[model samples]
Target: MLARLSTDNRTAFMSGVRDYSPMLMAILSWGLVTGIAMSKSVLTVPQALGMSVLVYAGSSQLAVLPLMAAKLPIWTVLLTASMINVRFAIFSAGLAPHFSYLPFRRRLLLGYFNGDVVYLLFQKKAFATGYVPGKEAYFWGMALSAWAAWQVSSIAGILLASVFPDDWGLALAGTLALVPLIVSAVVGRSVLAAVSVAGLVALVAIDLPYRLALPLAVLAAIGAGSVVDVIADRADLRRIRTARPAAGTADPTGRTGRTGRADLGKES
Candidate 1:
């Protein structure tokens, strides 16, 4: 059996919360909008609260709301929700390496808590310097903090939804919240390529039926990024493969081979 709670774990958990503090503003904003949307929709207060708790999926929830209100087909709603969340699949794959050492159950729980902002922050820190000790602690810290902030803000939004006016332009506020995160995540050429493609695709496909634009955009971005990642990975492998033999040949004498070593010795 594993020790689930330890001093290190507690410390890391708190640290994760602290590291994730700045991004909480964006998260809370989005959650607030999502909660307000849910409360204003056809769903009852209890139903909205239940969805907020059980689904905890702002994008999918929002995506399907208009469809639900318009009495669209059930299949359409389900499909749209699944497609909208396709990006989460990509996020999960990229995140797998960081927590591969953990057990399945623990990893699943962590995945549940690890949403977009936490994933981005963790990815930046982890990929930049490689994994250091206490990374797990940091990961959990960020995850829990994001989770808590989202739940609280959304619940607040839901409760106070009626008091809030529709013309408040909260959607724009939520979009503004994402600006920092979006800028921060675009760190490399590959990421820039992905973002460009996703944006272009989304704009072009904005009127696609069944609300397919979002998922298509996500797929486009993932495809672009994956290609870049593959090319980079292969290049790294080739470089390593070349360096290993060259290092072996050079040996301690700083010569490429036996003849070079002999020449150096003769010169000495």
Candidate 2:
């Protein structure tokens, strides 16, 4: 019986993996670019791998590379990386509900693997509608694929960087990878609008000191999203009110009374 149960669990995990193929592909593409960038940069293979394993943030890695190559002060590198990564605070807030139930150790492990694409995909597909036991395994599967691909690509790029000193224009590879990831993340009008606004703001403010423009763009996106979230929350309350009958003794709409399923879904 124990062996049978183990097989069942494996099957379920495999199902989740199959469900995430497209997302995994997009992640792989992004990982490739990140690897290429790391290889081309000044860092040695071991150092680049260490950053990938420890920091695991594409934007932050990219932002700090130029400064590191220039032999800038440690404070300058620290500030630049910090500004680039401040957006993760908001990402973590948005994802807290889905992950709050996890054990502390597991949560820390998940944090190590999570990235923008992984968070966004899990939000739209798995957590937004409702939680599913074992569904989080799919996220790790996706992350694992991307992580392996990135390491290989980076190593290859580093090896080839010396030979192809002709500048393969490898930096542009990141842009190519980001397009599909952006497409997969689009959920509703509010998110789409936020992306457009943020892109424009970032382009215009690219010259700002200390790379403050990136954070400013992030703030603008957050402000726009918060406004939308507030309006959506009000509408949700109105829905609940109308769904309840005059007496309010029970769930007239069957939503409040039935396992609280309606409330189980995320605010999105």
Candidate 3:
């Protein structure tokens, strides 16, 4: 399938794959833990496998499983899952600018394949370079690889849940593996603020019923990040405003220093 792509696109695609390779272990462990949890829950083997295939959201699945097991109303389960997955809305918004030119069905498929690591890597690598060509291919490279790894590990865990003992600490290993990824993503003050707020909120609300803490943390993080972004933007605007007149004064050409000869001619 990749053979049909242009050389540049194929290169971009492979770049994405190589960048994402480091996170494969983390993704696999998390998926395996999720699968084991689902298998041991109220869900039958078929139901577990179906959720792993269709939902493809480990966090939401883990959060909603207890509610489902408790025979909660369908709406409650749906609502809880929706809340936990609300961050995907933010992810989609971030991704829209890059993929907006694609067909609606294609965009929808891309959105479906989007995940935390893929979005993070895409933003760091592709998005940072602006909307250049071959970004779609790059995204697909990471997304497809992540999807395949997740499904395989999850299926394996479900089929062999009984073989793996609970004391193996696979869950802790998965969580630990993500720590570095999280730390690496904290590139700015806004992100740091968001992560701090999210962690604090999650810890505070850990005892909340129905795993409400997860959504609460996500919301808190978004709010914190938005506020920080606004502040930073305003600061930048102020700096620009303050510098504009000085720059104009220094140039005396009203061209914002583009013509370096203005000041030289004036001094002469």
Candidate 4:
């Protein structure tokens, strides 16, 4: 039993690594930028290292740094970071069903490691195949690979910021890396609608202070996506309802009037 479990875990980890491998470059590029940004920020080395290790959120780290650099109020900085991480709340809810049988502590660990890409890949597979054994392995596989790559890249960037050239264009590299992911995610009508709405909202609200546009765009995208999904589901249900036979979908003899009747002459 133990051997079986061990093999399952190994396979799961490998699957996750294989699936997320293409994304390594993108994540590494982003992490490098984040690391450099933190190193160049007013934060001390220890402070930057602690935030990268402890916070583990590139966006949140970036969000509060400018505020810190400006000597802003503590409450404002906290709020800014909180808003940037609001998507995690949605992720937690979406992933709850997959790990509901596990203890709270285990679930918490999974939540801690879950990233946007992890959530996206897992969700796409889950919806397509429904529940399958060893899902936890897949989850950990993708999450851990991403976490490792991110930490390594960011730490290197932080440590090497002084030596790294500004002309290396890590930021642009990161953006370009995201193109494949963005295209992959835009697959179905509902997803396309959500992305379109979110992009539009972000562009329209780009002037908002404290990076408020991000959360606004997130909310708008959720609303748009939910609306699209609900409409699609209702349409599907309506089609099913219309196609189903009414009350007595049979002749008085208790045979189906349509398909059943056609077979009677041949049977006789």
Model 4, 78-137: lDDT tens digits are 988988899999999998877787889998999889998889988877543335567888
Per-residue lDDT tens digits of candidate 3, residues 1-268? 8889999999989988998999899899989999999999999999999999999999999888888889989999998888778889989999988877788999899989999999998888746434677888899899999999999999999999999998998878878888898899999999999999999999999998767898899889999999999999999999988876554344445555636765568879
For residue 122, model 2's alpha carbon misses the true position, in angstroms, by 0.6
Candidate 1 per-residue lDDT, tens place, 24-51, comes to 7778888888999999999888998898
lDDT, ranked from best to worst: 3, 4, 1, 2
Each candidate's root-mean-square deviation in Å? 4.8, 9.5, 4.2, 3.9
Candidate no. 4 TM-score: 0.87
Residue 54 of model 3 has an lDDT of: 96
Any idea what lDDT model 3 has? 0.89
Q: Per-model C-alpha lDDT, please?
A: 0.82, 0.69, 0.89, 0.87
Query: To one decimal, what is the Cα RMSD in angstroms of model 1 from the true structure?
Result: 4.8
Each prediction's TM-score against the native? Answer: 0.82, 0.74, 0.87, 0.87
Clashing pairs in 3: none
Residue-wise C-alpha lDDT for candidate 2, range 1-268, written one tens digit per residue: 2244455455645654565555554454455556667777888878877876677777788788888899999999999889988887877777678778788998778776666666666666655423656566666655565566565655555455465443555445546656776876767767877887888899999998668889989998878777877888999999999987655244555655444544665443
| Candidate no. 1 TM-score | 0.82
Evaluated against the true structure, the overall lDDT of model 2 is 0.69
User: Ten-residue segment with the worst summed lDDT in candidate 4?
Assistant: 125-134
